[model samples]
Target: MSDHHIVFIPAAPHYLPTEQQVSSAKAALWQWIPEAEAIEAAVTEYVQFHDCGSNFEYVRCHVCGQELTIPQWHLLMEQDYDLERGFGLTPQTLPCCGNVASVNQLDYSFMQGFSRFSLTAINPRTGAVSAQQTELLQRQLDHPLLVIYCHV
Candidate 1:
């Protein structure tokens, strides 16, 4: 069987909300996804990738909009990662456009990203979140948000 996840991450990769804020966001998430099997928040010491799993399609350059091959992206990922420290998110010159950007800056087909913090809903009753509902959660966290849908 496949597992589905709704992962909410801050727009800034390193941003960590206060405990009270996280609690508020949790409450709001429960209200929004009442039937979810579980909802949890995490603050990690190192950056973690929030990926779309089987839903991932492609990655595109933000500047040139050219498709990036898997190998190209893998090389970049390797350049940015560390065994003890995780991703540094350093900017690199793109092969296609020569534009400098981090992996987090690229356009993902399924909203993948790197983050040190995340709030996740596991197997929610609903798959989609409305813009208004997202806005409400963002307000609770007091930060801009990126919502990722992952299927595994």
Candidate 2:
């Protein structure tokens, strides 16, 4: 469906910070997550080169109570896939099928990432993101959909 047009950038590759860095950030930053576990959650995000800040905002759905604003999720499978596991891993499939006949699925070819992008709704309950949330990544990053299908 047209609602799944927005392309959200997933968390970056796995990178762990040293205890010193974490402690230093905690001392300097205002909202430092205090606990190590809480700090790790935000550290391993799929931030993109385009995104300015580190923190991402997401709201929960009032109806189904599912996440609908994922800044980025992982595509489990890929031709250049690796075995090493990380934090926010996901299947290498698009959120098509089911009741909605999405055009961004295997049936239709992506027009070099051009088209339209609708902003995703935030889910408040759980910190999960949905496919409906998307914003045009960039004109230069356009492709035939298959290349970076679920990477963003």
Candidate 3:
């Protein structure tokens, strides 16, 4: 069976929660975020979360509408390496078409990322936590949050 995870990260690197803070955040998550199962702190710089079974076919070049291979997409992701801002792979020059494009520009079927913490809700009935709820959680924790979708 496939699984979907909505990983949450702090907007700033410095905003990453401390161990004690994680506890408080866990409480907030349980109280507010629907289907929140647990809050896990990352031991490494980034957590490599991947899709369970979906294969990434290809991504279209935002510039020339060219359909590029998955490896080409990975090249773009490698170029834009800022993960602290949530969606790490921001817009950059597409090697395939040489045009600036953001992650939102790519038509990708799956996503993965490195994060300092993850709030996992196993097979949540609601799919994902809402932006409003995340915003509220951010306020409660006094840290801006970035949410990324992962299927595994």
Candidate 4:
């Protein structure tokens, strides 16, 4: 069986939702991503989030325009980078072209990270929510949001 998760994180790493904000965020989630089930809000001191299993395939380097194979990308993900400490994937000298590259500079279609507050939707059958929907929700919640894809 395959499981999917759509996790919503704050756009800014330091942003934490208040109790009242959680309630409003939940409402916005329901309205925007109606297919989501068991929508919940969580506040974490530190969380290690990743897309261990998902549809993402390859990531292209922005510097050299070279694509990193799955194994190559997996190697990068395996590195011990602490998200709680505000440390994310660091830029590395690419083997393909010897240019400095980071996850942000890679062109791929999923999100991953740790944050203080996460608004989650479990097993959303419709796949990812649209950007327009997220934008509207962000405006309503008064917080920029990051949508992440995860499978466990």
**Alpha-carbon RMSD, each predicted model:** 0.8, 15.4, 5.4, 3.3
Q: Write the per-residue lDDT of candidate 3 for residues 26-102, one digit (tens) a residue.
A: 67666654564544545345533333235444567656877877677766666655566434545677777677876
Give the candidate number with the greatest TM-score.
1
lDDT of 4 at 107: 64
**Which tens-of-lDDT digit does each residue in 1-152 have in candidate 1?**
88899999999999889999999999988998899999989999999889999999999999999999999999988998999999999999888899999999999989999889999999997969999989988988899999999999
Candidate with best lDDT: 1
Error of 2 at 148 (Å): 24
Q: Which stretches of candidate 2 lie over 4 Å from their true place?
A: 1-13, 30-91, 97-152
Error of 4 at 27 (Å): 1.2
Per-residue C-alpha lDDT of model 2 across residues 1-152, encoded as one tens digit per residue:
11111122222223334445434433422232122222211332231122212223332332333443343112212322334432223323333212321112122122111122211221212232222221222111231111122212
Better of 3 and 4 by TM-score: 4
State each candidate's clash count: 0, 22, 2, 0
The window of 10 residues in a row where model 3 has the poorest summed lDDT is 47-56
Model 2 Cα displacement at 88 (Å)?
6.7
TM-score of each: 0.97, 0.23, 0.57, 0.70
RMSD of 4: 3.3
Candidate 4's TM-score reads 0.70
Evaluated at residue 107, the lDDT of candidate 1 is: 94
- Estimate every model's Cα lDDT from 0 to 1: 0.93, 0.25, 0.58, 0.69
Clashes of 3: 2
Give model 1 RMSD, 1 decimal. Answer: 0.8
